[model samples]
Target chain A: MAYYGTNGYGDDAMDTESSGPKVTVREVESGRCDFVLQNCPLALANSLRRVMLAEIPTIAIDLVEVESNSSVLPDEFLAHRLGLIPLNSMNVASGLQYTRECGNCDDHCEQCSVTLRLHVKCSSPENLLVFAKDLIMVDGRTDDIGKPVIRDSAGNGPLLAKLRNGQELKLSCIAKKGIAKEHAKWAPSAAIGFEYDPNNKLRHVDYWYEVDAKDEWPVNQKNAEWESEETAADFTFNPDAQPSAFFFDLEATGVLEPDEIVHQGVDVLQKKLAEIINGLTRSDEGMNGGMSPDGYEPAPAEDDYAYGRGGTTPYGATAYGQNGYGGY
Target chain B: MSNSAERDTEMANGEAEEDSADEQELLLGGLEKLVILPGQTSHAASFQIEQEDHTLGNSLRYFINKNPDVEFCGYTIPHPSETKMHIRIQTWEDTPTTAFDALRKGLEDMIEACDVVTEKFTDARDGFEASKQ
Candidate 1:
């Protein structure tokens, strides 16, 4: 009779067996410290600060068309009162003296004058009143209802009353006109149009991997991975499971250095030594020679040692056949 | 033939009326916030405010004046202390995020654009400081 016998410790049973060398899995949360150098232009920084501290003004004005008999102000007259002028009619004050020689005899060169050219085309003429005002009402205001609008009312225009939109109009009456100082300055011409979410985390994780053993070993061959895997399986296969031997390295976070781990490693020191030797060699060669074979030279000998005799002679004693100049 | 011609004429009249109505609406909308700054003949004037303080009113004035699209009108307001003035900007919109960002950036650029002016002003101020010293 043929009997079917099953091996109690079969290959399949062994494969499913959990028995193995227990691993002390440790989870290490570490970080690497890196430096970011940001250099802000001094001029830009000062400008930003200045702007932040300065009072910014807002100006606004409006123009409305009124009926001919509406007793409304005329655009030409208003332009004249507000110091707005046509491009062709701009004239610099003659009495003003320029330290820099004025090339334009008319006292109205581009350098000293401003040109305002406005052309409005309307299909139909109605009661049109130009209303203007600077929104930023600081200290300046119109003192009177009727101010003389300074503008060129020469072309296709009828006699009309005009006034500037704002009362406190600041004109360039200083040393120079048409210069940048006469004009208002604005910062950044364009805006960054992108949206930003502050809560977003950085995509890259900053970490420093280190081997616990002092001796150099293959990283892939380390038992830590297997031990960690086994420990993780035992702990319900949770990927976030911390191993018993693994730990966090908090010193590597931001500006802090991993002094404990770094000091323990000799690679950096060795690299620094190599760099110093290279630097010294470069400096020495550069100072003495242009990398020429004859660049190096021996130090000079001492003059007294080279000239003096090795044997000692009696004080004031003369040589043989010579009179003893120092004899008692 | 007369009936067809009458129908065409009516359609034309309706189209004209519609166009006129649209134009009137546009004119009224534009006029509501209109501002006119009359300046002297042969001279150009511009008004501006800081980006932070810019409003629809100021933006309307800028639009009416036809100021340079790229270059902001130059204007500044005296600080509350009255010791110094800051540059202002006028824009067409009033969203704080956009306005502040523009203003901050514009201020930075203005410093560069007006470098010579800034330097001169600084030197003049420095001279005054030295005299006091």
Candidate 2:
């Protein structure tokens, strides 16, 4: 059969049976989890990481209308801070429309948004620390989002700002559903650490060292454990070995669970493939009808940054050099 | 008498093909989903999936290789800068299966695998939530 380098993938862990891939959850908590995804390559593993980081949708404060502000923070500063607070978005996908698709109303309406009002006037003489919990879900429309995600269940959540006595900070903020690619606030996971070949069995890199490289270098316990019996007896590099097991150290914010992030990550890839299949199966003429040709248009910037929010948007930086052979 | 015209058309087609292959546009409705390489039998063939890297190619190969009918299935991204993924599939010669059939079946299998993961994760998620209370 001369398979893809019959001995290339020196991975005994590769499962050839029809049983499919395996996911063994290790230490799983409400906000974090450790797991190993087996019987897959780096491509699938990386796709999961990318999806969890930028594609998984979550609810965040997209827009904030400050009715009055006597607090220390400026309006946009306050708005940006409010936007960062993680909102409980368990029902976002089913409950609200992406502000862009909600053509029902140009302004805030039942179809598109959930209104969160923050009205606080410090009557106490001492300083006041305003937390995300203070942003009351006044409108019943917010039933979809539920409430803020407080990571420390026993303690008060993220601190928004501090105010002195007689100072007032009043705002009617709009929280909307979005993905991290558009605005970081919507990112479900704060971080995702993924590794396919932690021991570097693939020999992807050559370690540079001076004098007696092997004798000088110390072999870690984990790396030594991975060494086969023959290799442990005598060092022999497998030039064509392939990576099999993938370890994921996924840490999610209060907004989404570790399992949900992984599921949605795979879902992003599935939907992508389904779309490709649909495009291919369709006749050439009608192929354009269903497929969105205009690739990823980051959901319209919810914040106009009329607050003079100068974003460093690099324009026309990508230049493609001609690579066509003079004669074919 | 029409030799020049035929040559010009051939060159044009070649350039058009090169143009499409150069640009990887999986979701952009630009490139064709699959480009079957030339001069291979139905049982063994190389398919170039456009605008895709190892993410789809390697995962798809894993699924297709699981099929007992498949003798061999592997994929390679031609170059780092280029987004095209060339997947080579070989089925048992006697089996009535074609490489194209294996790819389609692999895609369905991948979807099934995704459903399984979602199901398992859902159970875990519910447990996590239940413990939160």
Candidate 3:
């Protein structure tokens, strides 16, 4: 309701030292939720979105050792598909260690990693659809931790591969801790839908239209509460208006619950800051003293700074420069 | 030759035979830095965080600037390849807090804010499930 071009949050949102967050959750279904964050700075909102998408570490299959395969899918292709399967890693961040950081063993030890094995052979006359449920943990050691998330009530999950009759496949893989930035398989969220200035009141996007502006773009349908009553398609432009509200519609992968991802993401963000704070307490050691580190030179600057669109054709150039259509 | 740094890369400097090593090195210490600006007290300093970009920088700026005692707070990623952010903080003259304390508070605020979102999202989720049944 606050997205109706209200300037009430102009001073308060910026001035308040610890202004409490105002959240309105519209809908919450399994693996998905629609919510609005109000009275929060756009930068802070973006941080949350970006952190949840890439920073929060999640468990996923990193290395796969194939034993045998007679199935139609190649070993590399099958391993890639296995990496995409969402594992149940709820509340396990505290226990897992990133394999790279856990230097106790060269590659992986019990403390740093977990193992899952799959060995199946088809004897039936028809082809068999192999699923993630078939991949069982060695010794069932992680039974308390959990298994691959079932895609449906029938216990069917992501299809890893298909095997014709008399075909056999065997594989043993290791799951390791990682962040989405390193590889997307570790990402916990299916999608983080970030929307700000839903009415385009900030004019962040320049609309391209051939005729009447209203005909090409309708008043935003999201603010139906006011748009329905007030059919006018325009409002006064406020050049100094800062974003004080935001809307995020997100969907969670089965690896973690919606709330857990937000919590872990915040933890990771704080940990990163705390590292810098810790660096403040440490002695400088005279800054690269006694030891020598290599040096770097500035990037080779071509005339790229003044390199405007000199090659633009006459017709295309008319839409930009001093006509209020600023070229980036 | 006087200001070689400002000149473009392709420009030819014939007179100056100065080796590249003699010129000042950019980022000599490989992103690990917490140097205080000359003539400034401990109350105002800069911190360099490694392996991070704007996701933390812009938001942390907003949080630290929220402090009434803070005089100024800002951050920048010196280079894209460096994967680090340099944050500068300056607190007010008479404030009890220091630059380091301001950064610590800003980071703590983000954690608490996350708790708020986690709680609200959980409640909304459970409430919706209850109403559905």
TM-score for candidate 1, please give it. 0.17
Q: Ten-residue segment with the worst summed lDDT in candidate 1 chain A? A: A319-328
Q: lDDT winner among the candidates?
A: 3
Best by DockQ: 3
DockQ class, candidate 1: incorrect
lDDT of 2 by residue, A165-195 (tens): 9889999888876667556788889898776
Question: Which of the predicted structures, 2 or 3, would earn the higher TM-score when compared with the native?
Answer: 3
Off by over 4 Å in 3: A1-19, A103-106, A142-146, A218-220, A223-233, A282-328, B1-44, B68-71, B90-98, B126-133
Backbone-clash count (model 2): 0
Q: CA shift at A133, candidate 2, in angstroms? A: 0.8
DockQ of each: 0.01, 0.09, 0.14
Q: What DockQ would you assign to candidate 1?
A: 0.01
Error of 1 at A226 (Å): 38
For model 3, report DockQ.
Answer: 0.14
**Over 4 Å off, model 1:** A1-37, A41-44, A48-106, A117-328, B1-133
Ranking by DockQ: 3, 2, 1
Report the error of model 3 at residue A165, Å: 3.5
**Ranking, TM-score, top scorer first:** 3, 2, 1
lDDT of 1 by residue, A44-160 (tens): 222222222221110101121222312344444443333321111112213221212232432333332222222222223443333222211222322211112223344222232
Candidate 2 backbone collisions, by pair? none
Return the interface RMSD of model 3.
14.7
